[model samples]
Target: MHYAVYFPLVFGAALGLLGPAAATRLPPRPATWLLTVGGLVAAGTTLLVLAILTATLIGGHSLLAGHLHWSPDVFDRSNPVPAVVGAAAALLLAVLAVRTAWAAVRSVVELRQAHRLARTLAPGDGELVVVTEPGPVALAVPGRPGRVVVSAELLRTFDAAERAVVLGHERSHLRHRHHLHHLAARVAAAAVPLLRGLPAATSLATERWADEDSTAQGPRPVVARALFEAAVRTRGAWPRRGACLSVASTDTDVRIRMMLAGPPRRRPLLLLTTVALLTLPVLAGGEALRDAHGLFREAALDAPMHSTPHPTSQR
Candidate 1:
């Protein structure tokens, strides 16, 4: 087979390098979707490439034995994939599968734990929780009925308008199910290390999504001020357990600038560019598989056919 079989690996590397930059340029909602979808595609293509490679090895061995009547030595010499390489690929695939499973299970367990804690704290009221604590804390806890937990310090730190902004931001997190997006990104990254950029990028996008939602609810300045004060108060403090989404979690400067700049305008060109970048990998992978299949067929056809002597006596 030709090097087309390696296209998926190359495409994955390109995504690892460039996906984050593309994600950052788009508006928050689209950017979030881009990260989630791109991450999934990248990881899935990597697995597909590995599967193709494994199939090539098996098909080559079978063709040489059945069609060409070739010895193991001849088969090994003719095949593009060496024994060591095929074995290594198989081993790597096993490792990735195990890791992906572990990550998925761990994520589910943690999410359940977070939900249980949230229920224990505020079983009566599913919407909001006001904790009496000296340090500032604000977070959206995802559960059966998601809750926005804010510390008394945080409540005292902001006026009614600022409180509205804070609540609005956390509510957006719950409404949009930002935690699931984050979990999906994490699972994809775990499956393929090349997709590691996605989880962080998605986190930023979700935070920005909430920031924009808060801005929509009230004055931009008030939302920005609320974010700034929350960050200042929570600086260096440990984030609360079950805090999947929080006002103070992301980069304060970037979030503040985004709010002050007003809502993001739709950028058709940038969106199209991101879509193209993500689509390229799938196209390349499909083409590679096609080429690899063609090569395998050609190899099979070219194999020497041994014909048995006909029954001359019977004729």
Candidate 2:
């Protein structure tokens, strides 16, 4: 196979390095979709390349070649993939499969728990549930009818405008289905170790998305102040259970600053370029597959035609 076969793996590592910073810089809504989808695509293409490499190892075996009517000698001579490299690829694929499966299971369990909690909180349509607590707490529970939960203590601390800001932020999470985006990022990270930063980046994007949404009605200062207060009030509060999304769950300081920085500028060029970069892995994978098929076809063509010996007449 051509050296391009390995490009997807290297590209994933490069994406991991750049993705987080890009997630913060871009507009939050687009950034959320880009990071989540990009991670999944990158992980998938990397797996494809690994599978191709693994196949080269097994397909090059003499016994397997005979069954497939392929010439092992020609295959070995033409194969660019080394035996050790193929072995390593196989091992990596197995490890990724186990990790991805475990991550997916955990995500599903957490989401189900969140849904149950939401159902318990509001049996009917979505509504706000205020719980009396010593400290501050707020979270959005996703379900058929999502519920927004807030602590009475936190409500008392916020003025009318800030209160609206907090509610709006959490509501945005439910409306946008941000939890699913997070789950996708989590599984992608598990499948591709190089993309370990993707989940955190997705978290930042979702939080920023909520923050931006909160500013729709009120001034930017109101949203910024509300976020700052939520972070301070819930500084030591225990995290919400399952996949319940909270207004102050991640990068509170950065989000507050971003809110104060004004709306993000529309940079179509950067967004388009990033999207184009995401497709490179998929293209590379296709190229690798084509090259591998050609290699095997050539081997099959070179296989010696053997005439079956006529069976002796039965006595």
Candidate 3:
């Protein structure tokens, strides 16, 4: 029961922490691979259904065929309850995987489109600045004079400190190449959807990282304040749609709360957590191997042991 619960959770945590890094690095290609390969994987799923059917026909599990068998037990038996529960979990995970992959795909398309548009949209060789969006929006379009955008609404909503913080946030993002981080993150996820959370965590961390640099002017709260204010004012205004920072879809509450709280306090606690995160896979793999060995041992014990036959000399 403990393994049943904790196994997936630890797996999820691993994905959560690792996902963002991948998302930040190679987002689009990974996402595309996930979609294509995922589709191919779906085709192979019939093998699972066939395996289950064959299992039912063979009258339960066997090891070494006639040489070994496992004693039936409540948990050891192929009960429908566990099967149903497992199926449900698999389904949920599949949905999550698909959603995350799609998001990466879309982000890639949008970002690339933004890049192409930047050429035509370029205002000619100065620090990158955007003027189209009405609300708060910040984008990093590559090339010297690489622009960092902020919506008019954002400027109207925030004080000078907050506005400066917002600009700085975008600047930090550009300077640190957070977009590349995002691409990496997406790539990792596309490579493995079970690792979806990896990208998500990275994205959150990068956003925070950018916030830290942008708000370095005295109070970091000013940056957080700007993010919250922008989200509230923009209502999820995507720049492609002629709008900037729209709060319509942003995690306004979460961003604001983080702003108020400021950055997380670093402590040795994170060291322990990092250790656990790094070691969890090995632990999980070990546990799985242990369980498999145990099952096999039981099967071996149940099967008949052969006695050595004595060879008779010519009598």
Candidate 4:
């Protein structure tokens, strides 16, 4: 509960939100690494504090009893402020640790598979089919091949230029390796649960990020038209699944708005929000520790027990 411990844990949680946000706006290369490091540090700090408190409680209780005797199957438990605070710290650390572990596993599996999948397709003069399914679709799978997959039905959905635009859109996804960003954001969030709000923010940012990437090639209307047409054609699966893992899965309204808006404001708002929110838990934890320590010192010696100073005759 010391400020040292609280600040790190809270800050870790706050930092957790940043990765996803950054993933959306920035490419995965630098941003993902930064977020991943932050999560590791935060989780480590949280676990360290919990471990310390757990050790203190176990040792303190044993010393109080002065022997290792199991209590007789007791149901009622005594309330002690230090013990309660210690327990809470321990629990919080445990949850964060578990989250980190699960996320680590997920990151390794999904991203590796996606990357491997990306290797299967190499875009040439013609398009490819990365995953076998029937629908109007086009998306990028990042790798050396970096597929611009299109379904048979999708080829008939639009004219040649529109088809090219659709392919261009998916190509932009591959160029940016947007799927990797999504995967990293997901993993980082799992690794650090405190940044729960991050995914939504990052998802929004990346859509804008890719929209800008697409517009750099041609007019926004071209990409917009292609997106709308392709989306409508595959309206059924758009709600349920990822089509060939190329299309950047995003909210319809948000993606359309980004296309219309033409890019982000360049404000560091999400990052700033993360920084501001992370400070809170850390402050609370530090204060809690200070208060607990001061209270212990004040109460430990102030209370006086009744004492008979004079020697008494046999009675």
Candidate 5:
């Protein structure tokens, strides 16, 4: 295989290293998009390289080559990947597939439960659903129309403007389908060990995106205050599961500071770098595919020569 196949691993590590900081510091919408896209590209490229390595190794074997009409001698002579490396790649790919499948299934089940809850909260009602509970709980439940569920007690605590901030934040989550962004990051992270931090970074970015959206309904300080209060109220609350959107899902301290800091500057350079990172792996994967094709073509061309018996052997 070509050396280019390994480039994605290095790029993935670099992206993982930069992901958290970029998710936190960049503009919320762009940051969410950058991290989500970066995670998918990195994870997908890693899988592609693994598949290529495994295929090359299998194709080089005599038994498989005979069935496939290729010359094992030619393929083995041309194959640059070590047997041990190929074996390890195959194992890793299998394990990642199992784990990713489990994660995806669990996420889907939880999302369905949230949708069910959304329907039960207020059937035939409009977009908003206010339920009475002792403690404060606010979340955006994704459904056909998307429902914003908030505890009645929570609403009573806020004045009209503060209420607007809370409603606006949750609405932003529904409006942009922020849960899907979080879901994609989560599934990708499950496959790539280097990307373990990616899900948290994505969650943080989504939260910030909602916070910024709330600014349209009220002042930044008001938005910050409302979120801070929600965090305090839900300090010891149970953690949210799946793609559910919550006001206090991430760190309130960082969000409060962000709101007080005014609007995030749009970083064109940072965006360009993110785009480049995503593009490089795809291009590298294409090159690796071309190399693999060449290896197989060369093996096929040598097959007939290998199969023909020498006159000396025929006697």
Candidate 6:
């Protein structure tokens, strides 16, 4: 039982180490989905293992009262779990609880802040908002009736083709709800420190997704050039908002390189590999918990009886 509790953590660490390589091999859409889903599953399984460990500790303590006659001698046995291990599990569970709460509260606060900012943006025709700002700002703000905001400077800076590319990119983000995916990745990373890099990877992938989308509407070079020009023009000038998904959020150099290379081909093998990696740990954890439950049950049944009644003399 004690050893089983570590499986999820070990798997999470392994995924964290290997996930980047996997993401690189996959195309934008698959890569984004893979990272987001994998991070979520890893975090969820880690918490499940922690919960099982905590429950086992509580159950052991209750059973010990009957088995060892309320004596501290129960610690001498090492079948169910050692007292030292249980104590450590309790401490870890406490820390995880606090961390999870903090992450949830922080996510809520950021959402509220994003909504407030969205309210302040002046409405424009349809989903477009042309902010009268000097900076070359362009972003997709996600919410009910999501809006694509472009600054006055941005409109004036780009030509017709470039503007079309920009609109296509931001529209892709709004249509696909890329911000939700980003938010989920962020929350998962916050919950599981091992997956801290996941959010960044997903962000890059989302940028690529939008890039591909824009390319569908125009020449690849045109879209790539638009992204490069926007990135350069808006460098160090755009406002950082939690609620807005911007066209220039990812690494400009990487995006340029990917765009120049053209859209990636689908790699089914990579997807299969990623699926296997995610499934194995969950199955192992479930099997371990099943075995641990059986062991605990047997231990309970074998506990020493408090007293034995003398057999009555037979007639």
- Give lDDT tens digits, candidate 1, residues 253-297: 887887798778889997888788777778877876776566556
Worst 10 residues of 5 by lDDT: 234-243
- Local error of candidate 5 at residue 59 (angstroms): 1.5
Best by TM-score: 5
lDDT of each: 0.77, 0.88, 0.49, 0.55, 0.86, 0.76
| Descending-lDDT candidate ranking | 2, 5, 1, 6, 4, 3
- Candidate 5 lDDT, 81-174, residue by residue in tens: 9988889989999988787788788778887877877777788999998777668878888977789878888888999998898899999999
Tens digit of lDDT per residue, candidate 6, span 1-315? 546567788888877787666556689888888888888888788877776666556655655546544322332353466557657777877887787777777766766666666666654337788888877888887755777888888999889999999999999998988877788777777767888888788888888889999987688889899999987876666567765788778788888888888778788886887778888668867976886666555655566557756678433
Per-residue CA lDDT of model 2 for 1-315, tens digit only, reads 788899989888987998898778899999999999888988888889999999999888998999999999999999999999999999999999899899999999999998898888757754788877678888888988888888898999889999999999989999999999999999999989989999999999999999999998599987898888887787656447658888767899888888888898778999999999888888999999999999999999999999866678533
- Quality of model 2 by C-alpha lDDT: 0.88
Our model 3 lands, by Cα RMSD against the true structure, at 10.3
Cα lDDT for residue 49, candidate 6: 75
Instruction: lDDT for model 1, please.
Output: 0.77
Better of 1 and 4 by lDDT: 1
**Candidate ordering by TM-score (highest first):** 5, 2, 6, 1, 4, 3
Please give, for residues 74-124, the per-residue lDDT of candidate 4 as tens digits.
101221336677778667657766876787677667656655655545434
State the RMSD for candidate 5. 3.8
Runs in model 3 deviating more than 4 A are 1-13, 17-111, 132-136, 142-145, 240-250, 272-315
> What TM-score fits each model?
0.82, 0.93, 0.51, 0.61, 0.94, 0.85
Better of 5 and 6 by TM-score: 5
Model 1: per-residue Cα lDDT at residue 153: 84
Which residue pairs does candidate 1 place in steric collision? none
Can you write out model 3's per-residue Cα lDDT over 1-315, one digit (the tens) per residue? 125223434444455454444322332233223322322232222223323323322323343244344444422453332544455545645654566567667766756665555556655745556575654565555433346666566567667887777677666755665555556555545534555554445455555565556657547555666676665665445553211112223344654565566555544453345445444544554554455445445645665656766677434
What residue pairs clash in candidate 2, if any at all? none
Comparing 1 and 3 on TM-score, the stronger one: 1
After TM-score superposition, what is the CA distance of residue 240 in candidate 2 from its true location, in Å?
Answer: 2.0
